[model samples]
Target: MQTGKIGVTTENIFPVIKKFLYSDHEIFLRELVSNAVDASQKLKTLAITGDFRGEQGDLAVRIKIDEKEGTLTISDNGIGMDAEEIDKYINQIAFSGVSDFMEKYQDKAEAIIGHFGLGFYSAFMVAKKVDIITKSYKEGAKAVKWSCDGSPEFTLEETEKESRGSDIVLHIDDDCKEFLQKSKIEELLNKYCKFMAVPVILGKKQEWKDGKMQDTDEDNVINSVAPLWSKSPSEIKDEDYKSFYRTLFPMNDEPLFWIHLNVDYPFNLTGILYFPRVKNNIELQRNKIQLYCNQVFVTDQVEGIVPEFLTLLHGVIDSPDIPLNVSRSYLQSDANVKKISSYITKKVADRLNGIFKDNRKDYEEKWEDLKLFVNYGMLSENDFYDRAKDFSLFTDVDGRHFTFEEYKTLIKDNQTDKDGQLVYLYATDKEEQFSYIEAAKAKGYSVLLTDGQLDVPAVSMLEQKFEKSRFVRVDSDTIDRIIAKDNAPELDLNETQRDILSEAFQSQVPKLDKSEFMVDVQAMGVDAQPVIITQNEYMRRMKEMSRYQQGMAFYGQMPDTYTLVLNSDHALVKKILSEGEASTKETLKPILSEIKGLQARQTILQQEQGKKKPEEITQEEKDDLSNTEQNLSKQREEKKQVIAGYAKDNGTIHQLIDLALLQNGMLKGASLNEFIKRSVNLIK
Candidate 1:
């Protein structure tokens, strides 16, 4: 027997590990169980290599809880360390100082176990005292028992035999009795060791007999030694991939498609990535991709390994190249990590392209489900954008789909504007913008459905990617204005008459909060709607961007500005103009005649003065010019008042204004009620 203090430069190392090693205390189970699996695998390797002459049998790890004895034991038939081996690996924890050790591994607590030879010490965190009983597999090896309290001192001696390998017995502290509960150990094993490459047995399998669960002779193995991700892609069938996905996420809908990743040369990476139905609530499904080291589970928060956009996918990514317990910042800065991200991006794009080229009908059927993820990748990753554009599609309102190149070629002949730029028309809400879409279709123009959550940002990105192309919403303008092939005819109304008609309808428009309108009269064909409401593309796009991103709050805060266009050629607009002209003509005629005479006199006086030098100009001439200008200003005011008087009580003007508002989904609440009542009265 022997007793000695642990060999450490600092007085002891246990306190340092307990304080700075694990921020999450529950990871202790993962560390201890993982160490046992590693030991078991090592023994198997030694037997295969002829280093150990003894038989290699039953490498299964077992976890047992003795609730009455208040202890938990993890036993494994693996390589067990003699006293000298234990002293080299465990006793000598070479610590310079707490600050130095912490500074070295501050942000990397997860990496400490395998990298720093501290896997066994993690048990001390939850156990008041721990005992290691073992007989090494090496020839002439004597069985030994090692015991320690939570301190620097320990006892190592030859003791009663165990078959071989080691047993780690933990006398759990009062605060950590949760580890002794069979259910608790089972849960931790399920989480961290579910995919480990060795059989981990927790307890006996249970059967429901006599209305209760009882143990059977069969062992309850808690892990899959060779999970689906570790297998070759050719060995996995589609249903097998789906079965694995269902196990990973049982409550989720079956994935639309999956990409099997298997790369070996520059960096070892293997996994399966599933493209789930992400059309709705993209933010809800993010971070479902898991990252693993070899077969050991590392983290589901894999934003550092997988690109931010691909985090929407679900499945496992195993790579021994990436450190299992590194900081996110460290992971992101790794060269291997960058290569892994680029490879994944290329792989996903290739898979999508293959599916599209092979069975376009099936691909189109799944486009609605795949849209959010594809758009996100294109918008976030540049290389992904370059590849995705080949297979990405545009679905028209008629439910027919076309590739970007195909659609651009189809529309370039007629839809290109006078500035040599092609115009792509789209609709967000097919139901609300139904009339606008139909109007566009009437003119032989196709409107696409860009209604997904990411479509707003995607539209802005596509415009930059496609050559000399722009995307416009169907309801953003009149059909002719949205994709202008030729100049629209000008209205024949005079300036004063135009003002009179505009004022009449503008005054009757409902007063909505955070809304503004500017009225314009256009000579559209008589068949067009009498009044149409349209929003400017620039402001609307900016507001849409503000909803998902930062730095555009100013645009979001501004009122929605709409262009209220009144068609002068329509019979209803023509009637309103005629009625307004008749009612205000008599009052405005005398004031207009006076203003015309005064303006002619002022023009003559200014011309005569221009012919003379500043000092030579007569004082009487200056007075004449000043009086003419004042009279002209006063006359314009009187003319405006007469137009206002006729506009205040025009019923036709109010009805036309409401019709445009209702079509655009802008009319609501008390104003919508008023519009309904007035519409009923007009019908009567």
Candidate 2:
């Protein structure tokens, strides 16, 4: 027997492997199991090429545990090594056995997956002493044994062995006793090797035949030798895809559809992507797409592989081009990764367009669930938006769906404003904004139910994409303002009359927390509601967007401002004005006469001094003009004070304001209680 240190420039390789090689030490099992699968695959290749004139035999990689001996062994019945082979592949520290083997037989070994030449060394992370015993497939070969004990020193000698493949034995360290547990090993195997190409056996299969689980004669195979993604698309059925989806996500809802990605020319990528039921929340459904490298599981954080919106999808993406150990910085800079992202975006768009063109009625039926994903993609990726423009759908409150161009054609003549801008009216909440929706529909206009969480941001983007188009929330303003065909007929009241009625109605407006209202009088035809509450669409949308974006937090903190529009043409408003004026008319007649006398004097003085220069005006004339203006202002205030006082006690003014507040979903708590009580009293 002869022993010497590993062929390395530094003695620190073992220490680095133990403490710093991988972020999680549990990955050691994955590396060992993958190496075993690679070895078995190589033997199969040699058999197919007639290089070996013997049976391929059972290729299942077996894992065994000896708790009393404190050792775990992974054995494979594949290509083994002789003494010279061990010295060249195992004794040399940095050289990879699989790398040179692939170089020799590149065409026959495509599934072999070993990179960086460091996977075998990772066993040092959890083992104190590791052993390798193997015998070559050649006609006359002797089995060899190699052993190392957590250091550069190793020993190689001839050993008697009956098998033809390799056996790797690991002596568990005291610090990593948790790995010895059966359940822990099973979990790691399920997560990383669930889809491996070769059969992986852990122990004897168990059955609960006699009220308790007992080991049977059969081996417990733990992996799927042929996953759906590795098969041809022509061999897969819709039910097969759905079954695979169910396997990946056991608790998730059934997927709406799936896209099978199979490409070889541009950096081989093959996988299945499913369009899950992604609605209501975008953040909750991310990180569900598991990324793999040559069938070995890598990670679930695939934001770099697919676009941000496509991360909302679910299923597997296997590509040999992706480096096994991925870094965020590398993913951002890798050329192959960028091409994969672009390709995924195009595939998603093409699939959606195909579905839309093939069966539009079916697509429309599923739009309620599909809109969120499509809208998010269109709002984020520029290329996706360019492709999705033709197929993206719009469903109105009437439950009829239309494409962007189709909707434009449907409402172009009636919904266009005087400035030739097409008005796309939408409502965020059908129940809360029902009156607003009905009001629009009453005017022969259509309203879209833009109630999705991402709909607000998407509408902001559509404003720039659609030609001469703007999306307005149905409840943001009155129908006249949303799609104004002509300037509304002006209110027929004078300035003082307008202010008096405005103040009267404004005084009855409830004080809601985080809300402020400004009163405006408009002549909105006799059939319109007496009082309507409308928020500015621009400010409202800005505040909504600030909920998702970072730099616009100031808009979220600002109080919601609404316009309290009082219709002058309505009888309730006209009656309030006339009655308030009538009740105060007797008291204001003499005040008004004195104000008129002062105004007449001021007009006479102004005419007399019309041609005079500033210095020519006497002090008495200036004092008289000033006193007349002051007295007139005082009299109008006294008159308005009386009228506003009467308006406060009037039930009609309070009722109108409360009804408007209730319609806008702003009336609640004590304010709502008070309105209810007041409403009851007025009916009594």
The model with the greatest TM-score is 2
All candidates' lDDT scores? 0.82, 0.85
Q: Candidate 2 clashing pairs?
A: none
Clashing pairs in 1: none
Error of 1 at 109 (Å): 26
The candidate 1 region of ten consecutive residues with least summed lDDT is 323-332
TM-score of every model versus the real structure: 0.91, 0.92
Q: RMSD to the native, candidate 1?
A: 5.0
Compared with the true structure, what per-residue lDDT tens digits does model 1 show for residues 580-601? 9999888888987898898888
Global local distance difference test of model 2: 0.85
Instruction: Indicate which candidate wins on lDDT.
Output: 2
RMSD of each: 5.0, 3.9
The sequence of per-residue lDDT tens digits that candidate 2 reaches over residues 251-281 is 9999988899999868889998998887777
List residue ranges in candidate 2 displaced over 4 A. Answer: 18-20, 326-332, 586-641
